[model samples]
Structure formats: C-alpha cells, structure tokens
Target: MVLKTFGWSFAVTALGLVAAVLYGGWTAFGIVAILSVLEISLSFDNAVVNAGILKKMNAFWQKIFLTIGILIAVFGMRLVFPVLIVAVSAQLGPIEAVELALNDKDRYEELVTDAHPSIAAFGGMFLLMIFLDFIFTDREIKWLAWLERPLAKLGKVDMLSVCIALIVLLGTAMTFAVNAHQHGGGHANKAETVMLSGIAGLITYLIVGGLSSYFENKLEEKEEREHEEEEQARKSGKKVTAMAVGGKAAFFMFLYLEVLDASFSFDGVIGAFAITNDIVLMALGLGIGAMYVRSITVYLVRQGTLDDYVYLEHGAHYAIGALAIILLITIQYQIHELITGLIGVALIGWSFVSSVRRNRELAAQEALGEKAESHS
Candidate 1:
C-alpha cells in the first residue's frame, strides 16, 4: 500500500534532486531538499482537506487531479503565480518580472516582500472564509464541541460567515491605516491595497465555493434519484450501474481545490525566500513536496483514513483557521515559518490521539453491550 501510494512521489523526488544537483551541485540539491520538506510541512493540512474533497470524485477525475492538477500546483502556483503577482504589483511586464527574478533576485524578493501585505490580505481572507464556513456548518461530529456548537448555532444567521469575514477585513484594514497614520509617512496606500485585496479574496471565495457547492448538491440529488431508480431496477432483476460524481460537479470541485491550494501556497512561497530566492530550486523542491501531498491525499482516500479518524478533518480545518489568522497577523509582524509549520503538525497530532481514544471508548461500550446480550 505504501509503495503503491508513494511510488510516484518518490520518483519525482529522485528526479528533481538529480536535476538540482546537476544544476548547482550539492548546494542546490540541499536547498531543494529543504524547500521540499518546508512545502510538505506547511501543506499537510492541505492534503487532508484535499482528501475530503477528492474522495467524492470518480477515478477519472482523481487521475486528472494527480496528473494535470499536480502540474498546475507546481508550475502555476509555485512558479508563474508569483511572477504574475510581481508583474501586476510592480507595473512591469511579465518578461520584465521574470528577468527581475532571474537577474536581480534581491530586487525580485523585495518586490515580492513589498507585495506581502496585499497577498496576505487576499489569501488570508480566502482561507478565513473557508475556516469560517467549515466551523459554521452543522455537523454531527464536532471536534471542539464547546466552540463549534455555538458557531453552528450562530451559522443559522444569514451570511454570518461572510459578515464576520468582512468585519475582520475591515478591522485589519483600519489597523493598517492607524499604523500608517502614526508612522506619518506616505504608507497609507497600504491600507487601501489591503482593503481591496481582502474584498477580492472574499469575492473569489464566494464565487468559487458557491459554484462548487451548488454543483455538488446537484450531483448528490442526481445520485439520490438514480439510486432510487437502481433500487427499482434491482427489484426487477436488472443490473444497476455504479454512481460517480458528474462532470460539472467534478470540474467545480477541481477548481475549488486549485483555489484552495493557491491560498495555502501563499505563505510557503513568501516564506521560502527566507531560505532561498532561487525560484528554480524553490519550484523543484516545492514541486517534489506537492507530489507527496497529492500522494498523501490519494493514500488517505484509499485507506479510508478520514472515515476511520473522524476528527482528522476537524483538526485540519482548525489548522487552516490558525494558519489564516497567522497570515493576517504577519501583515504587520514577522512570524517564523517553523512556528507556522509546528502549529499545524501539533493540531493534527493531537487530533489523531484524540481519535484513537474515542475509538477505544466506542469499542469498550460495544463490548459491554455484547456481554450483556450474551448474558441475557
């Protein structure tokens, strides 16, 4: 099972490392290795969340995710997306941005870092919406019942998640404005930039998430209708076909996954510069890590890990929430990537332990009931 799941990831890692070593020797290889580890550490929650979505997809769509989706994650987000951000933010052409990245990495890094506020605002708000929606939805299983219960009740209020997200954006924007005012410089443009970026992020989430949910609901309804027909057909001694997610639903879910990956990658891309500004090494390293994440997602789906450890999904969402808040906080203050990665790992680990305990408790109860039945 391990080899089946991780074979492709391992292959990619070997090839990527070989290319890195050939390009810049051992130093490049080492940087690539570190970057790969960094990406995986930062994106473990991403894999978990992805598993929850990908399981609903059919085999064909799942293969597409592994193949085409990996390409987009590696080249689109890790490579081209950053450059696009630099080009638009610095008012330069795409070629100029790429040239800046290749020839003047320091300037490139500066431009990227300078654009952090807006990036943070956009990605932060998008992730915050995701976290908000997850916590607000009523679910039978609640990891943090004390908090989730209240949130679920409050979720009944119309657009509560959007409202809260907007309020957060407003508060952060105001804080930025206040800081700029106190500094008494021409830095107030940052406040406006952050405000606009946050709104854009929120809107992007609404459009993408809303469409995905709509199509998913339609798929479920169609499944239910077909299931009824299949039952009737079975009663008539006819063979019933298996059900899979429809094309439209799968496409939207795939789009949602890509956007979610982008939001998760924002921090990693920016944080990677702290280690190395070489985009090639970063892509190679992060690309290898992306493959592992995809592999892990597939493994989780195949193993039914999420179903076994019910609270794992909750933990992943909570980690995403924490990461979202951290991104927003880093707009003004510097946060180490180690701290970011640790928070996610710690939450996931704790949830896994909790799941084991819950399982034991459930087993003990079942054993007691069986004993009573046997006695009777």
Candidate 2:
C-alpha cells in the first residue's frame, strides 16, 4: 500500500531536488530542501481539509484530482500564477515579468511583495469563509466543544460570517492605508487596493462555492434516481450496470479545489520570499512539497483516516481560521513562517490526540457492554 500510494510523491520529490542541484548546485539544493519542508509543514492543514472533500468524490474523480490536479497545482499556481500576478500588478508583460524574475530577482521580489497585501486580503477572506462555515455548522462530533459551540450559536444569523469578514477586512485595509500614507511618502492609499482584492475574494468564494453546491445537489438527485432504478432492476433479478460519477459535479468540485489550493498557496509563496528570492528554487521546493501534500490527501482518503479520526476535520478548520487571521495580520507586519506553521501543527496535533482518546473511551464502553451482555 505504501509503495503504491507514495511512489509518485517520492519520484516527484526526487526529481525536484535533482533539478535544483543540477541548476543551482549544493547550496541551492539545501535551500530547496528547506523550502520544501516549510511548504509541507505549513500545509498539513491543507491536506486535512482536502481529504475532507476528496473522500466525497468517486474513484474516477479522485484519480483526476490527483493526476490533473497536481499539474495545475505545480505549474499553474507555483509557477505561472506568480508570474501572472507580477505581470498584472507591475503593469509588465508576462515575458518581461519572467525576465525580471530571472535577471533582477530583487525587483521581481519587490513587485511580488508589493502585491502581498492584495493577495493576503483575497486569500484570507476566502479561507475565512471556509473556516467560518465549517465551524458554524452543527456537527455531531466536535473537538473543542466550548469554543466551537459558541461559534455555532453565533452562526445562527444568516451571512454572519461574511458580515464579520467584511468588518475585519475594512478595519485591516484602513490600517494599511494609514501606514502607507504615514510611511510611503505621497503614495496613494493602499487600503483601497486591499479592500478591492478582498471583495474579489468574497465574490469568488460565493460564485465557486455556490456553483459547487448547485452541481452537487444535481448530482445527488441524479444518484437518487439511478439508485431507485437499480433497486427496481435488482428486484426483477436484472443486473445493474455501474455508473461513473458524472463529469459536471466533479468539474465544479475540481474548480473549487483549485481555488482552495490557491488560497492556501498565497501565504507559503509570500513567506518563501523571506527565505530566498530565487523564484526557480522557491517553485521547485514548494512544488515538491505540494506533490507530497497531494499524496497525503489521497492517502487519507484511501486509508479512511478522517473516518477514523473524528476530530481531525475540526482541527484542520480551526487551523485554517488561525491561518486566515495570520494572513490578515501579515498585511502590516511580518510573522515568521515558523510561528505560522507551528500554530497549525499544534492545533492539528492536539486534535489527533483527542481523537485517539475518544476512540479508546468508546472502545472500552463497547467492550464492557459486550461483556455484560454475555454474562446476562
């Protein structure tokens, strides 16, 4: 199972490292390795949230997510997406942006860095929605009941999450504006840019999330009809053919996943620049880590890990909430990537332990009940 599951991830990681060595030598190799580890550590929560969604997909859709999805992730987000951002933000052509990245890396980094506030605002809002929705919705199993219960209660107000997010975004943007005016010397207010990006993020989430929900509902209805037909056919002693999950639902879900991946990547990309300005090295390293994350998502689904660990999803969502807030704070200040990564890992780690404990208690109760029944 291990070989079959992780062979590709290992191959990709090796290939990324080898390319790094061949291009930039041992020092570059070391940098790439560290960046890769940083990406993985920062994205464990991503894997957990991905597993929560990926498990709902059929085997065919799941394979597509692992295969086609990885290409989009590595090339699209890690490589092309950054260039696109630089090109658009700096009012330069894509070719020019690439040249800037290769020849004048510091300038490249500056353009990208200048774009950070907008990126943070957008991604932070998108992720904040995911965290809010997950926490607000009632669940039979909850990890941190005290905190979660209150959030869930507050969730009773329709659109409360969006309302709160807008408020936060406005406040953060105004702060950025103040800092930019006070410090940037005659530059236009940066808060407007941040606010616009945030609004874009909110709109994006609604459109993507709404489309996914609509398609999913349609798929559910189709499945119900097919199930009823299959039951009737079985009653008539007829063989019912297997049906592949329809493409439409999976397509929307696929789009949703990509957006989610982009939002998650924003922080890692910005944080990586603090480590190294070499876009090539950053991409190679983060791409390798991304491949492993994809592998972990598949492994979680295949192993039924989330089903076994009830609190893991809650933990991941909570970690996401922390990350979203961190992203917002990053607009004005530098938060070490180590602190960011540690906060997420700690939450997920504690939740995993809690889940194990819960399992033990349930097992003991079941065993005692069985023993009493036997005696009776």
Candidate 3:
C-alpha cells in the first residue's frame, strides 16, 4: 500500500535531484533538497487538511488531483503565480515578467518581495476564513472541548465567522499593514492594497467555498437518498445499485482544493526567496514536496487513519489558524520559517498523542464494562 501510494514521489525525487545536479551541480542539488524538506515541514498540516477533503472525493477525481492538480500546483502556483504577482505589482507585461524571472532574478525577487503585503493579506484572509468557518461549525467530534463547545454555541449566530474575519482583516489593515507601508518605505497605497487584497480574499473564500459546500451537500444528500432506497430494495429482495457522486460535484471540490493549495503555498513561495532566487529550483523542490503531500493524503484516506485518529483534522485546522495569524503578522514583521514549521508540527504531534490516549481510555472503559457484565 505504501509503495502503491508513494512510488511516484520517490521516483520523481530521484530524477529531480539528478536534474538539479545537472542544472547547477551539487550546490543546486543541496539547495533544492533543503527547499523540498522545508516545503514538506511547512506543509505537513496541509496534507492532513487535504486528506479530510480528499476522502470525500471519488477515485477518478483523486487521480485528477494527483495528476493535473500537481501540474497546476508546481507550475501555476509555484512559478506562474509569482511571476503574475510581479507583473501586476511592478506594472510589467507578462513577457517582461517572465524575462525578468529568467534573466535578472534579483530584480524579480525584489518585485515579488515588494508585492508581499498584498500576497500576505490575500492569503492570510482566505486562510483565516477557512479556520474561522471550521472552528465555528458544530461537529460531533471535539478535539478541544472546552474551546470548541463555546465556539460552536457562538456559531449559531448568522455569519458570525464572516463577521469576525472581516473585523480581523480591518484591524490588521489599519495597524500592521499601515505600519508596514510607512516604515518599510512602500508606496502610499500599500495599506489600501492590503485592504483590497484582503477583501478579495474574503470574497473569493465565500464564492469558491460556498459553491463547493453547496455541491458537496447536494452530493451527500443524493448519496443518502440513494442509500435509503438501496436498503429498502435489499430488504424487499430487489436489486440494489451502487451510489456514485456525479462529476460536477467533484469538479467544484477540485477547484476548492486548488485554491486551498494556492493559499497554503503563499508563504512557501515567498519564503523560498530567503533560501534562493532560482525559480526553477524552487519549482522542482516545491513540486517534489507537493507530490509527497499528495501521497500522504492518499495514505491517510486509504488507511482510514483519520477515522481512527479523530482529532487529526482539528489539529490541522488549528495549525492553519496559526499559519493565518502568522501570515498577517508577517505584513509588518518577519518570522522564521522554522518557527512556522515547528508550530504546525507541535500542534499535530500533540493531537496525535491525545488521540492515542483517548483510544486507550476507550479500550479500558470497554474492558471494565465487559468484566462487570461477566461478574453479573
């Protein structure tokens, strides 16, 4: 099962490293390898979150995600997205942006860095909305009962999550973004750009997430109705057909996953500049890491890991919330990539440990109940 899931990732890693060496010798190879590790560490939470969504998707859609989706993630987000940002921010034509990326990487990196405020704002707000919606929603399983219970109660208020997200966006734009613009020697419209970008993010979240949820719920309802019909037919000795969610639902979920991936990649794309300005190497490295993330998601779903470790999704969402706050904070201050990676790992690790303990307690309770029954 492990090889079936991760075979391609391993092969790609091997070939990518050889290509990296051919491109720039061992030094390039080392940098690419380091960047790959960095991407994986920073994005481990992303794999967990992705697993939660991907589990609901059918096999065909999952294949599309692993194949075509990887291409978009590697090229579209890692390469083209950064260039597009530079082009828009620096007022360069698309061709000129690509030329700059290929010829004068320093200037390219500078423009990308200059554009960080907007990038951070947009990605941060989008991620913030995700975290808020997740935390606000009521679910049967509660990883942090003390916190989640009250939050769920509060979630009864209409649009509470959206309202909170907007308020936080405004607060950050006025204070942190403003200070960043002035103190960082940015243009007069820096804070305004941040504000607009954040609004764009929020709106994007609403449209994409809303549509995705709508279709997913529809699919679930369809499945449920079909399941009921199947059960009735079975009881009556009638033929029962299989349940399948249609392609349209999968398509929207695919769109949502791509957007979610792009939001997660914002920090990594920017942070790669701190390591190296070689965009080719960044694509190769980040792409390798992305493949591994996909593999992990598949493994989780196939193994029923999420079902057993109930709190993993909660941990991933909390990590995402932390990452969103960190992205917003980065509008004014620089944070180490290590710190970001560590926080996510720590949260997930704690959750896994807690899940194990919970399972053990459940076993003990069941054992006690059985022994009592025997005595009686």
Candidate 2 wrong stretches, greater than 4 Å: 180-188, 222-245
Give the per-residue lDDT digits (tens) of candidate 1, residues 111-146.
787788889899999999999999999999988899
Listed in order, each prediction's TM-score against the native is 0.93, 0.92, 0.94
Collision pairs in model 2: none
Answer with 1 or 2, whichever has the higher TM-score.
Answer: 1
Best by TM-score: 3
- In model 1, the runs with Cα more than 4 Å from the true position are 177-189, 226-243
Clashes of 1: 0
State the lDDT at 70 in candidate 3: 89
Model 3: number of backbone collisions: 0
Clashes of each: 0, 0, 0
Query: On a 0 to 1 TM-score scale, where does candidate 3 land against the true structure?
Result: 0.94
Query: Cα lDDT of all candidates, in order?
Result: 0.89, 0.87, 0.88
Which pairs in model 3 have colliding backbones? none
